[model samples]
Target: MKGLMVKDLRLLFSQKKTWLMYIMLCLMMSFSMQGAFIVGYTVMLAGVIGISTISYDQADNGMPFLLTLPTDRKGYVREKYLLCLLMEACGAAVGIILCEVTSLVKNGSGVPADDIRSAVVVIPVMLILVSFMAPINLKYGAEKARLVMMIAYGIIGAITASAVVLMQDIMPDLGHSALVKIKVFFDETLGGTYFWTVPVVLTVLSLAVMYVSYRISVRIVSNKEY
Candidate 1:
């Protein structure tokens, strides 16, 4: 697992100029885009770059050679998730720093509370996105994964929108009552600190989804001839 991680990290960082360009792009965007947008953009870049390592591994019949190493399918999936999460962390840190620096330059103050909230919110969101990408890439290979991802995201968006619309229409009274009770429970239990429960829940949910994705990827890779 450690060897796989090192190999992937080296593959990612081998192109120093590409990373420098990515940093430059982020720096430029920080001046023009919303701070929250910059955060999402940087983290998305990190996730995509991390996913690209799988392509490199798949290229030139490299999978057979990689499997010949100490790692197995499960270890490979675990390493991919770990490497992607690490890159996302690095990206988020870079983004927050840039947002802070830009805010200071613009108004001589730190980032706004809303921006800070958005920045923190992007972490689990990006993790979930990476989780989905990993399994799709593992199943479809890098070339087909982009198409699969687009379709999957489209389906998810449609379903989410439909659910929101249906919820608004169906059992509105019951839903409102349930929501009220839930809010009351949170307010009674966590009081003012209930606001943080969202992120904590999201983090746990994302980790669970990532673990499931990892298991699926292991199955996909394990069954493949290579």
Candidate 2:
């Protein structure tokens, strides 16, 4: 597993142009985009970076060669997840720092507490993204995984639209007053504990998803001849 991790990290860092491009994009967005948005963007790019290493491993008979080493299929999956976590965490930290620096330069003040809170929210969201994407890429390869994810997104959007329409028809009061009531419920229920509870819950859920994803990937790879 340690060797696998080193190999993946070396592959990731070998793409100097890609990393440079991502850093430039993040720097540009840090100045222009919303603080929270920049954080999410940066972390998502990091996730992509981690995912790309899988593609590299699959290229040019890399997987066959990798299997010739001591690491097994499960170790490969675990290493990928660990690499993703490390990269995304670094991205989030860098993004927050960039946001603060940008705010200081532009407004002579630090970013708002709410904005920083929102920035932190991106970590769990990207974790879920990474978790969902990893096994799909492993099972179907990158090309087919893209199509699957697009179809999945389309289905999810369609269902959400249908649900919203159904809600509008079933509960005619689901407009302004209902929205306010929902907001009030959340605020009253979570006002004090919202900061810690929401993040902790999301992080735990994301980790669970990652665990499931890891197991699935292991199964998928282990069954393969390579």
Candidate 1 residue lDDT tens string, 98-194: 8889878877888876566656777789899888888888888888998998898899999999987898798667778888998788667865666
Instruction: Give the worst 10-residue stretch by lDDT in candidate 2.
Output: 191-200
Against the hidden true structure, what lDDT does model 2 obtain? 0.84
lDDT of each: 0.84, 0.84
TM-scores for all predictions:
0.84, 0.92
Model 2 clash pairs are: none
Clashes of 2: 0
Candidate 1: global Cα-lDDT? 0.84
* Predicted candidate 2 versus true structure: per-residue lDDT over 41-84, tens digit per residue: 87888888888788888878678888889987888888999999
Runs of candidate 2 with Cα error greater than 4 angstroms are 175-182, 185-189, 192-194
Q: Where does model 1 exceed 4 Å of error?
A: 161-192
Candidate 1 least-lDDT 10 residues? 190-199
